[model samples]
Target: MNPIFKNILAVIVGLFVGSVVNMAIILISSTVIPPPDGADVTTMEGLKASMHLFETKHFIFPFLAHALGTFTGAQATALIAANHKTKLALVIGAFFLLGGIVNVFTLPSHIWYNVTDLVFAYLPMAYLGGKLIKKKKS
Candidate 1:
């Protein structure tokens, strides 16, 4: 198999799996911690408008979702890539980071939440994921 093709496929699968994990966490979180009463969380616009109604606790699941999703994705990429495993993992992290940045700009989250999510969620998790894979391989 072509190394380039394998790397590309790894990235695609990693991103897909990561996104699925992210959505699953969000779905499970909604069940575990229902949104504030009368808060319409069905749409981004609604959620953004209702951000003021949420407490700090409401952000925990989202942070976990982002971090875990990134970690899973990076790990998968590192595991599958034929070469430059860490670089591939970091690429996945960059992708998620871009999404996080866009979410921050589009949504009306608290400054602290935004900072924490953006700083701690994506890249760090991805790096950890890559390291975990490397350690396991060694």
Candidate 2:
């Protein structure tokens, strides 16, 4: 298998896996809390009511999911030719984890802002996942 192509596949796999991980985390977390008793969850106002709950419990996990996804994606990519899969995965994981930490800082103080941030965050992550997948083999 071509190294580059393997990486590409890894990224695709990462994107799918990462998206699923993220959504699962979101759904499970949201359910445990259940929308604020009677508070609207649609409007920014409603979202704010839930922000503390979300940030408190699952924010880091999302980051972890992103990081792990990235690491996995990169490893998948490197697998095409690289022998040191573990090391490369660690490197990619570190890169991704750092990115996620930075992302946390970008979050608006406003809870409603996340909805806007959400779209911005996910796809780029997929792209980044691809980048990891396509990274040069160690």
Candidate 3:
């Protein structure tokens, strides 16, 4: 396989897996975690509001989702290219984790912000997952 093609595929796989994991964490965790103070914690109400915005904007989530995918895909590609080192994973995870934390704080909605947070929680875990996946396949 060409290195460029392989790299792109690696990124796609990583982004896909990351997005699914992000969604799962967001949906499931929302049920249990209390809303941040001064923010709405009600899932139904929050989702309704989100839907309204999504319906009107029509592009925010898709754009954001794909952007997240792009970033995650890049991370995965980097991880895979790094020869599956835990140290590399840790460093990559840390960068993403910090970036995620910063993003969470910037987001206005408690829920969406937290969704990003949940997505980020997997940064380190994703690296670990990569290690396991790469290990078995190789």
Candidate 4:
């Protein structure tokens, strides 16, 4: 297979895998930690309307979902990419980061949650994923 094609495929796979993981976590989050009363988490409008009712506990799963999804996606990319493994991983991170930035504009999350999620979730996890592959190769 061509390296360029493989790399493109890697990115696509990473994005799909990350999205699946993210949605999976999100789907189960409310079951694990119930939302505030009347909080409809089913739609964008519902989430936006209920944002003010959310507590710190409600933020935990979202953070985990973002971090773990990015980490897993980056790792998958690094594993499959023909070359530039770390760079590809960072690409996945950048994609997720962009989404996070979009969420910041669209959602009404708490400042602390925004800061923490933006600072710690995407790139760091992706870097760690790339590093994990590198270490394994050594």
How well is each residue in 70-123 modelled by candidate 4, as lDDT tens digits?
A: 999999999899999999999999999999999999998999999999989999
| Backbone atom clashes (below 3 Å) for every candidate | 0, 1, 0, 0
For residue 116, give model 1's deviation from the true position in Å: 0.4
Q: Evaluated with lDDT, which candidate comes out highest?
A: 4
Against the hidden reference, what TM-scores do the models get?
0.97, 0.45, 0.44, 0.97
Across 1-138, the per-residue lDDT of candidate 2 in tens digits comes to: 776565456445544554565556555654655544554555666665555545433454444455445544554534542344444444444544555556556443435444433443434443454455455432
Question: Across residues 1-138, which tens digit of lDDT does each residue of candidate 3 receive?
Answer: 776565556555655555664555454543454333344435555644444333213324433443354345435655565353444444445555665666546444456545744564546454654565557556
- In model 4, the Cα lDDT at residue 63 comes to 95
Pairs of residues clashing in candidate 3? none
Candidate 3 wrong stretches, greater than 4 Å: 32-99, 107-123
- Model 4: lDDT equals 0.94
lDDT of 1: 0.92
Q: Considering lDDT, which of the candidate structures 1 and 4 is the better prediction for this target? A: 4
When summed lDDT is taken over every stretch of 10 residues in candidate 4, the lowest stretch is: 129-138
Native-referenced Cα lDDT, model 3: 0.49
lDDT value, candidate 2, whole model: 0.48
